[model samples]
Target: MDELLIRLRNPHERERAFSDMVKKYQQSVYYFVRRMVVDHDDANDVAQNVFIKAWKGLDGFRGDAQLSTWLYRIAHNESVSFIQREQRIAGISLDRIAHELPSTLRADKHYSGDEIQMKLQTAIALLPEKQKAVFIMKYYDDKTYDEMSAITGTSVGALKASYHHAVKKIEQFLRGEE
Candidate 1:
């Protein structure tokens, strides 16, 4: 890890470090952003921004948290900011997307594996922002609750509650209970 940090600290080794970081975390960041935005293009854009922000901020990183945790916090902030800006410009609430999902899911059978995935995505999209953040960091990023708490600055109990609430909401959504 120290060797990697040394490589990361060198300007000439920046490309390799950046590439390694991207390779290591890109998918997690992409999916986390995608869960928030529900748009592939927007997710891609936000994921790129997350990496860019990380690269710029790398020198100042004090290693207080795992590098992955730090990157996730960046991704979370970028995703929320993107969603807020999009909501203001489009006059559309992310909530409406959740409410409309059953119809959308039923309409498209061509994408077989994706039907359930679409429902799942819709359910995730419905989560309150903080709950969604915790859920994504915990589940999608495979982060420990402790890491999630640090990244979100929420207590472990709160993070656990948020994840539980998110799961219940998703289960209800999937079952057509809500």
Candidate 2:
């Protein structure tokens, strides 16, 4: 990533650098977006938009954070914007999305999970958005609270609390108590 950033700054090498960066980060970005969106096609679209936005705004990148963090931030915002836009256009709420996620995941060609995995997805879907993001980043992505705080602009204390709440809720959901 450091090498890519160096190449990114050089006028002549920027294209190759961007290409390499995309190659390096695409799967992580896709999965990150996918976890939020559920539908594979929507995830693909939002992930692409994240990369495009990153490419267009690369010149303005201030290097205050790591490239992965910047990209994750973009992915995060784009995913949220997508859900908000969907809500506006389709009159669907987050609860509706969560309610619909299981069937959608089951229908998705990319999803090969069994019933338990589907239920876990449903549980995750039921989380409030911030908690969901925190859970996904910390548990699935194995990110530290500090890194999450930087990417999400949330306090570490809040993120930890959110994660704890999310875990408890997911456990409740999984145990069929919720």
Query: Which number leads on TM-score?
Result: 2
Q: Give all TM-scores, in the order shown.
A: 0.85, 0.95
> Number of clashing pairs, model 1?
0
Per-residue lDDT over 61-124 for candidate 2, one digit per residue giving the tens place of the 0 to 100 score: 9877899999999999998888778878998776777788778877788999998889889998
lDDT of 1 by residue, 67-130 (tens): 8888888988888888778778988787786778657556644334366787887888777777
Error of 1 at 40 (Å): 1.3
Flag regions of model 1 displaced more than 4 Å. 101-114
How many pairs of residues collide in each model? 0, 0
lDDT of 2: 0.89
lDDT of each: 0.80, 0.89
Stretches > 4 Å off in candidate 2? none
Cα lDDT for residue 58, candidate 2 = 91
